[model samples]
Target: MSASQAAEVVRMGVLGHVPPMSYRNAQGEFVGYSVDMARAVCQDLGWTCQWVPTSLATVADELKQGQLDVAAMSLLSTPERRSHMLFARPYYTSISAWVARPGVALEAPGTRVAVVQGSAQARFAQSRQWTLVEVKTHTELAQQLAQGRVDGLLAPMMTVVGLMAAQPLQSLQLQVQPRRDPELTGAASFGISPMRPELKPLIDGALERLERNGVYDKINSRYLPFKVN
Candidate 1:
C-alpha cells in the first residue's frame, strides 16, 4: 500500500522478558527475533507498527482489551490460548532444557529445579516429580542456580542459550531431559487479538513470503544460534 493507506499504526504487544525472542536490550530498546519478525510483517503489510513491551501475563490482557492488534512473543498455541486469540502461522518452535551449575548431577526424579514464573516448564517439572522453585524473572532464576537455592532451572532452550552467552557460568550446563518430546516442544506463533479477523491472513501471508524468501531465517538466526524450526 501507499503511504496514505499506511497512515494507521498497528499496535503490537511484545515480550519484555525472554532473550533471543524478545527483551529490552542493554541499550533500552526492545529488540530480538520476535520483535524483528513482527516489524517485517508490519512492513510487508504496509502498516506502521508500534511495539509495546509487555510480560506474558499482561500480553493476553492487553490483546483482550483491544489495546494490541498482535502479540508477537513466541506464543505457544495451546487449547486454552486459542479460546480467545488467533494465531498466525508459527514462526519458531520452543524447546525446553535444564540449566544446572557445575558438578550437579540433576538427572534424577527428585532433583530440585526452578522455573520462571508462569512458564510451561512448571508443568514439565511437576510431571517429573521434581521439587520446584518459582522465580519471577530470569535474573532471579540465575540467582537461584548460583546461590544453590535450586539444583537447576528448567527453562526455554533459547533463554538458557542466551544466559550461557551473556554470562558464562563456569558450572552451568544446559541439558535436554530424557523424556523430551511433543509435550516439551511447542510452536511459537504470533498471537492475534480477536475482532480483527482480517489481520491474521495478512500477517500469515507476509510470514509465508518471508520464510519462502529466507528472510525469516536471517532474522531468527540473528539472536539465536540455532534454528528453532
Candidate 2:
C-alpha cells in the first residue's frame, strides 16, 4: 500500500462507554482513555481512525468479521482471544470485584451475579459457580441490580466505581478484593486481530512511547486514580 493508502484511516470498534474505559456522551461523541490511546497510535502511524461504535455484546464478532482493524474497546488477552487475534503488552491493570445494593452483599453458592457476556468477569463467575445472568450492557446489569433481579455484579473495580459516581444511588456498593488470583481478578492487554502483525508491533511501540511520555497516565487520570498503586 502507498503512503496515502496506509493513512486512509482504519476502523476501530468500541463498546460505547460502559465507564472508566470507553463511552459515548449525549452528543454521541466518543471519549475515554482507550479511544484516546488508539487515536494517538493511529496518529503516530500517520493513519486516521474511524470508530465503528457498537455495544460490547457484539464487539468480538465485529472484530472477527474484519469489520474493525482493532478493538479500541478494553478486552483481555485470553487463550480464546489468542486463537483469533494478536495483542499488545498490557498498558493498564485493574482488579475485578462485585457490586451489590447498599444493604446486600455477595455470598457464595446461591448468589446471582450479573456479568457482561464475553467479558473476563463472566468467566470468573462461571469458575466460582455463581448463578450467572449475562447481559449485553453494563447499564442493563446495573438496572437489574436496582430492580432486585440479581444479587450482584462482577467487573473491574474502577469501572464499577465510575458507574456509581456517574449514577449515585444508595443501593449501589462496590466491594473490592485486591489479593484475588490473577486469572480470576486481574486483566490487562488489548485485543487486535493477528492479521495485522505489523500493526501489533506499531501499537506496542506506541504504547511504550505513551508510557514514557506520561500520555497514558494523563488519559487514565481523567477517569480513574491510576496513581494509587
Candidate 3:
C-alpha cells in the first residue's frame, strides 16, 4: 500500500482477551462484541481496520504515543485517561466485581487480589489496599485465581462471568461478589488516540449510524445475554 493510503488505515487495538467483549477464536482471529462493533464502524467509515493486539496495561500509552489510532476494547473514561486520550460516545455501561473460591473473605486487609494491570479494577484494588497480583491478560487472570495463587480476582462483572463459562475455569467453583465502585462503574467507550483527534467525529458518527440501523443490537445479541448500552 502507498504511504498515504496506509496512513489512512485505522490502527485499531483490541485487547488480547476479555471474553465476550474481546478475544481470539479457535481460528486465531479476533472475534467478539467489541471487535464486531469496531469492524462495523470501520465498514461504515469505509476505512480499513488494521487490528493491533494490545493489553489493558499498555493501551493508553500506545494511544498517547500514536502507536494505535483507536482502542476497540471497552474502557472506562476516567480523569487520568482523559488527560492522555479522547473517548468516543459511550456504547455500554460496566460494573466491577470480585470473584473468589468459597469461604474467602475479600474484605480482609492485604487480601491478595489478581487484576489486569493498569485497569480500573487494579486501581480500585489498590485503593482498598489489597495486595495486588497484576496480570497482563484475561487468561492469566483466570489462571491466577484458579491456581489459588491469589485470594481473589477483581475485574468487570461481564468479564468474570465470561471467564467462568470458558475452559480452564468452567470447572472451578467460585463465588462472585458484584459491587459498584464509583470509579469502576460507568459508561464505557472506545479510546481514540490524541494523535488522531480528527477521527473522533467520524467514529462517533459511525457508531451512531450502526446503532440506528440495528447493527449494534444484532452484534450485542450474538455475544451478550443482555443489552449493555
Q: Which candidate has the top score in lDDT? A: 3
Q: Please write out the lDDT profile of model 3 over residues 1-229, one tens digit for every residue.
A: 2445434789999975888889889999999999999999887777889999998889999999999999998899887789879999888899988888899998899999999998998878888867999998977988998888999898988798789898777898888888786988999999999999988998898899898999989999999899887
Residue 93 Cα positional deviation in candidate 2, in Å, after optimal superposition: 0.8
**Ranking according to TM-score, highest score first:** 3, 2, 1
How much lDDT does each candidate structure score? 0.75, 0.71, 0.88
Better of 2 and 3 by lDDT: 3
Total colliding residue pairs, candidate 1: 1
Whole-model alpha-carbon lDDT for candidate 2: 0.71
Candidate 1 minimal-lDDT segment of 10 residues: 170-179
- The TM-score leader among the candidates is 3
For residues 1-229, write the lDDT of model 1, one tens digit per residue. 6666477588888777667777888888888888899889887878888878666656666776687888977776665567768998998778777777556666677788988655667656767777889777665677777777888887777777666665535455544443255666888888898867778888989999999989888997787667776
Candidate 2 lDDT over residue span 1-229, tens digit each = 3587465677787767566678887898887777877877777677788888776556666666667778886666666666766777676666777677555556568789888888777876778857899988876777777777888877776567666766543444544443255765444666676666667877788788878887777777776765521
lDDT of 3 at 196: 97
Model 2 clashes, total count: 2
Off by over 4 Å in 2: 1-6, 102-107, 168-179
